[model samples]
Target chain A: MISLAGRDILHAWGKFVFTGVGLGLLIGVTLTMAGVYRGMVDDAKALLDNSGADLWVVQKDTLGPYAESSSIYDDVYRGILGMPGVERAANVTYLTMQVRRGESDVRAMVVGVVPGGPGEPGQPGYLVAGRRITRGHYEAVADIATGFQLGEQIQIRRNLYTVVGLTRRMVSSSGDPMVFIPLKDAQEAQFLKDNDAIVQQRRRTAENPAFNRPGVPGLLNAAIASQSANPYVNAVLVQIEPGYSPDDVAEPIRRWKRLQVYTREQMEKILVGKLIATSARQIGMFLVILAIVSAAIVAFIIYTLTLGKVREIAVLKLIGTRNRTIAFMILQQAVGLGVIGFVVGKISATFWAPIFPKYVLLEPGDAARGFVAVVVICVLASVLAIRAALKVDPAEAIGG
Target chain B: MLTKGIRINGLKKRYGKGETAVDALKGVDMQVAPGEVVGLIGPSGSGKSTLLKCLGAVIEPTAGQMTLGDEVIYDDGWKISDLRALRRDKIGFVFQAPYLIPFLDVTDNIALLPMLAGHPNNESRQRALELLKALDVAHRARAMPSHLSGGEQQRVAIARALINRPPVILADEPTAPLDSERALAVIRILNQMARQYETAVIVVTHDEKIVPTFRRIYHIRDGRTNEEAGEGRAFE
Candidate 1:
């Protein structure tokens, strides 16, 4: 038999296509919401990957550096480096703040790395342009996501640092691009007080009677010098020997150094599971609402279309068209609409993903699942229209 | 009862119960011979529509007997199982409005009945083409229902009614929407098709212009039918 649904759609192709396009845009938003959630998890993972460390050593009992505030002495890495199965260790500090470029400020995660050469645990893994931070101060490697150019001057705090190198995809767990500065500058940026506060502190220190004992004049200067500097770093990143497991090296650091240690797997859990759990839930709620809204729109459209054909349906029924055939026609139309909408949505999401403010990761597996979901939702949405069609009386076509 | 025609005896239909009951068709008797076109005429509120519905098997006669071409369709209740299949294979209907599926072209509209009866698509279309030629609508076979003129649409509906070659055709107000000349033309086509296919045709109508053409007419009033003879003049 000729397809009733196909012929009807062809008869009014413009209406069918325009309706499908509208539905497709809704499906696109749903898919894009799912992609945004995926991107958050990926950004967290990329942050860990670019750190180039097998283990992370943080202050005792702290979640640290990503999920919570953590502070340890900058000298802790030296002790960790001397441990067995340790190939290298480096001090890393993370401070998420606004940094000045020429006129406008850009939000980025300022990273403090020791001015050792490449292959150090905390330095950026690779640079896309220019060299790494080869100097002890005023040299920086900026992630390309910051829109920074090579050899541009950017101010971290009171000091101006030149962006000597540009890296790609090196972002913090929160998706802020990382600006790599030498450890000294970051330490000063993180902890230094303003000049007025420093002067007041110095006055307060000299007035204290314990330091004015008439024989220890050098003690006040030494104490004041100590107050001007910060010796704490956020975490110590460690690389292990070739044959060592992450857990094997991490246990010794926790035992001997008395600091909290996290292996690669545990750090991933901290970043993905704990750090972004609320945002993930928020996206999940949006996805659920979008699905329900999509189902409703489809149901309304199909119902209106079906209602308009009530007379034809009654005539078809009277002319010996089976109830199954009528139901199938309605179902086929709904699925056809869904197929059109899905294609439009996928194309729309693909074209617009890069322009979003945050990263949007669209995976193939998610798309497969989305296609199945659209079909199933369309089937379910057509049920109301099918029921209405089936309830039509064939006798109505032969009026009294 | 004729072997190739439709016969009904003491057909009854009552709506509701007790004081609110309505006896629409009470003990009505009618028959139409094969290759004969009979007119059922009555004023509004008479039992004409109820009788047509009963002959078409669209409504169950409360206490009656109905037989189509020697097949007993209703004794006290339904004698034939699957009333839907009975309607598809043994009965055809034409209505006041053509009511063709707007999406389908003229050929598919006529071919749909045979297709529903499990005929092959090509064979169904062949049958449809033969009827369309007989009804003088062959040139417009591929046109959609919306594009056809009213007379052309009525002709297509008649072709659709004959496509399955059922033993009986029940046409209710088939000329209600046409002018006097177009009404006579539709009746002529129905008569020609009935004679050609050796099928019984019963037309329920109030069109006074075509009333004198039937050899026999059943005039129904207040739940009963009175048989009478017509002038039997051919519209041609």
Candidate 2:
């Protein structure tokens, strides 16, 4: 038999297509919301991947240095380097701030990396343009997402450093682009006070008799100079020797070194599970609401369409059309509408994803799931219309 | 002799229980022979609709016996387990409003009955084409119901009812929406189709315009029927 539903849709294609487009746009927003959540998780993973660390050693008992503030002495990596199975360790500090470029500024995570050759744990893995940070004090390597060009001088706190290299996908867990500068420069930028505060500190030390007794004249100046320098780093990144498990190296540090150490898996849990959990929940709620709205729209549309055919349906029944046949026609129409909406939604989501400010990672797996969900929703939504159609008495066609 | 058509005996239908009971059909009895067309006339609130519903097998009769061709279809209760199959294979129905499926073309609308009875598409459509030619609607075979005029649509509807060559057809005001001339035309076509297919046709109508066209008619009143002879006027 010819498809009754298909003929009906073709007969009024403009109505079906326009309604599908409207539903498609709503589905697009739902898909984009899921993509946003995936992007957040991807950003967190990218942060860890680019760092090239097997383990992270932070201040004891802290969730940081990504999810929270963490501080340890810059010399902490020296002690971690001597542990068994530890191949390399580097001091790294993260300070999220707005770095100035000409007149405007960009929010970036300024990372302090040891001025070493390639393969340092905290240094950017590879440069896309120019060269890595070769100068110990005044050079910077920035992620291309920061919109910085090669040889551009950017102000980080009081000092100006030339951007010498560019990298891609190097972002902090919060999705801010990373700019790598020499360890000492990042330290000073992180902790240095203005000259006025420094001068006031020196006078305050001099007025104190404990430091400036008449016999010890230089003790006051030495104490004031020590107070002005910063020796703290956010965390130490450690790379274990080949064939050695990170858990092996991290266990001793956690047990003996009086510091918090996390293996790669544990840190991923912290970043994805704890750091972005609330945001994921919020997106999940939006997806649920959009699904319900989509179901409601499909149900209402199908019900109205069926009601319009009451006379025809009664005749069909009187002339011996099966209940299953009538039910199937309505079902096929609903699923057809869902298929149209899905195609439009997928295209719209792909087109608009890049325009979003944050990363929107649209995974193929998620899309497949979304398509199945839409079909199921359409089938469920068609129930109301099918019931209404089936209840139409064939006797009504005879006209009482 | 009992002919190859429809035979009804003591057909009854009641709505609700004691104290509020309403008998819609009070022992309706009628017969229409093959190759003959008959009219059933009644006033409002008469048993016309209830009897039609009973003949169509759309509703169960409280007590009755009905025979189509050689088969006993109803006796106090349904003798056939599948009333839907009975309606599809042994009975045909035509409504006041043509009610051709709007989405379907003229050909498919007529062919749908045979298709529903498991005929292949090509065969069903072939049968429909033959009937459409007989009904003089072969030119508009591809036209949708909306594009057809009222007279054309009713003709197509008659063609649909005759497609399966069922033993009996129940027509409920087949020409109510047409003018007197068109109404006469419909009656003429129904009479021709009934004779050509050797099918029994019972037309339920209140239109005086085409009532005289029937040679015999059954007038229903107060849930009962009385047989009468019609003018048998020719359609000119």
Query: What TM-score fits each model?
Result: 0.97, 0.97
lDDT of 1 by residue, B165-193 (tens): 88999999999999998999999999998
Supply the global lDDT for candidate 2: 0.92
User: Can you list the residue pairs that collide in candidate 1?
Assistant: none
What is residue A246's positional error in candidate 1, in angstroms? 1.2
Tens digits of per-residue lDDT for model 2 on A137-185? Answer: 9999999999999999999999999999999999887789999999989
Stretches of candidate 2 exceeding 4 Å from the true structure: none
lDDT of candidate 1 over A1-400, digit per residue (tens): 7888999999998999999999999999999999999999999999999999999999999999789999999999999999989999999999999999889999999999988777899888888999988788999999999998988999888889999999999988878999999998999999978889999999998898776457876888888888888999999999999998988899889999999999889999998899999999999999999999999999999999999999999888887889998999999999999999999999999999999978899998988999999999999999999999999888788867
The docking category that best describes candidate 2 is: medium
Weakest 10 consecutive residues, lDDT, candidate 1 chain A? A208-217
RMSD value for candidate 2: 1.7
Question: In order, what is each prediction's RMSD in angstroms?
Answer: 1.5, 1.7
TM-score of 2: 0.97
Worst 10 residues of 2 chain B by lDDT: B227-236
